[model samples]
Target: MTAGASYHGQPVIKAPVWTWQIPWYFFTGGVAGASAGLGYLCELRGDDALARRAWAAAMAGICVSPALLIADLGRPQRFLNMLRMFKVTSPMSVGTWILQGSAASTAIAAAHAWFGLFPRLARVAAPAAALLGLPLSTYTAALVTNTAVPVWHEARRTLPFVFGAGAGLSAGAAALIGADPATAAPARRLALGGAAMELATTTLMHRGLGEHGRPYSQGRCKHFDQAASGFLAVGSALLAARGSRSRTAAAAGGVLLLAGAVSTRWSVFAAGRQSAADPHAVIDPQRAGIARGERIGGARTEPVARDAAAPAGPAS
Candidate 1:
């Protein structure tokens, strides 16, 4: 089967309604979640300056993430509807509550750093933000994979790690850019580990996808994925050499890691969209299921009259 082939005389797949806003939301939200946790780690290490910088990054991400989500929803009012009720089975609903908690706690932490207003509350708020951050960093993977898209669904087991690693890379890059060398050492280590994890999980995801992974490795999607991989590799190398090199090199490495993180989110979004638009990508799985004696919903076990020359009276 080819990308353009039809199934049962009709297109087996339809294009996804999601747009660029979704990918941006995923990237920013992941960054915010990881940055919040990184800030708490810095605080625990007694690095107030670096902690403040990480909190600032989290604040920035918190501000942008909602706007991206609203834009993708295509109506400012629709976001309110999402908060009307919570469903445990719905990743989006759970994510909405998580984002709310993360944003409020992060905002309070940022306030204490930026002003003397919440000095006493900072200890509690900061830790709470970090706790919420754990879920925020990984829930987007659940949200994406919960959909009907074949590639996203098939890669479900590995997507969370991929997204979490990307989030760590983004947060570490933000810290490296904003903090001093001594304070930035943790960030460098995080970038190194995140780069390695991202590379490994991405490889595993694609391999697990089998033929369904073709969309990710072909055309424009391939370019984005390759670029992300290259950037991550170079950034990791530069970060490793930071002790022997100038801060300028370290900063450049951070920037590259940020680029790679954003590109990776974009690549995943595009590949999922492409997979949804290809008929073969949707049909082949069901065909395999049928071959294995699995009863596919809405599928006929017997040939239709139109497909057969005559209908059999009865089966022996």
Candidate 2:
């Protein structure tokens, strides 16, 4: 009935339309993580202005992430409620707190950049921000991998590295796709690295999950997402492997990587919702596993409780 919205009958999915929060999380996480890595690379290359801008972007990304999460939730106040319980086993909580740390580092990095520009205030924020950004970039990966969702949760082995690669690629794309030669070199390298990382991680992620892979690997969404990701990975690798660098190629490659990253997020989000929607995803495998275990002979089971044991025990 609305101008832009489709009637899917109360938000259920013929295919997944996972809200903007999913993309926001993907983009913001990549931006923040990539910015942090870019800042470090800037320091190594001795480009202070670019370094400063990267930090500012990191701050911006961090600041926006929590707001997006709150907005996505039907009840905003529930986000605050996460702090009430301390559950290390819960990545949701860990991710929320990581955002806090990321924000603080971003602020410090900005201050450092400002001071480096001023020269007189160099002692204040630079060193601290530089130190913090490293962890900030990496922890975002841990945050995603710790979830219970099969596609995401099972990606624990390689998710952090994949995320890191995406972040680095995004940072490179933002900094280097322009005409300036100074930012271009580092940007190019970062993009190549990102492309490689994502490709490898994606391959590993898919290979790692065999028959349990319907969520991301099946359906119409998968066709676009998988191809998009594969193309980006290949394009980036080609750019990386080439002896002579082409700006046009680099730009296009970066765009491909960015597109791939977006699709990766979309696929992941849709898949998770799908996984949750079907009870068979949870029930069927579990029942089968239980049946298999029950068939095993001579396995000593745990003792029954006092109530169940009473009948097994002597009367009275």
| lDDT tens digits, residue span 35-138, model 2 | 86677567667887667667766767777777887888778878788777767777667666666666665666666676545344444444544554555555
Looking at model 2, residue 189 earns an lDDT score of 73
Models 1 onward score TM values of 0.91, 0.74
Score candidate 2 by lDDT.
0.63
TM-score of 1: 0.91
Q: Candidate 2's error at 243, in angstroms? A: 11
Note each model's CA RMSD in angstroms. Answer: 4.6, 7.5
Q: Candidate 1 residues 246-307, lDDT tens each?
A: 67877888899988998899899999888887777888777777778885445556654453
Measured by C-alpha RMSD in angstroms, how accurate is candidate 1? Answer: 4.6
Model 2, which residues run further than 4 Å from truth?
1-18, 77-87, 114-148, 234-249, 291-316
**Which residue pairs overlap in candidate 2's backbone?**
none
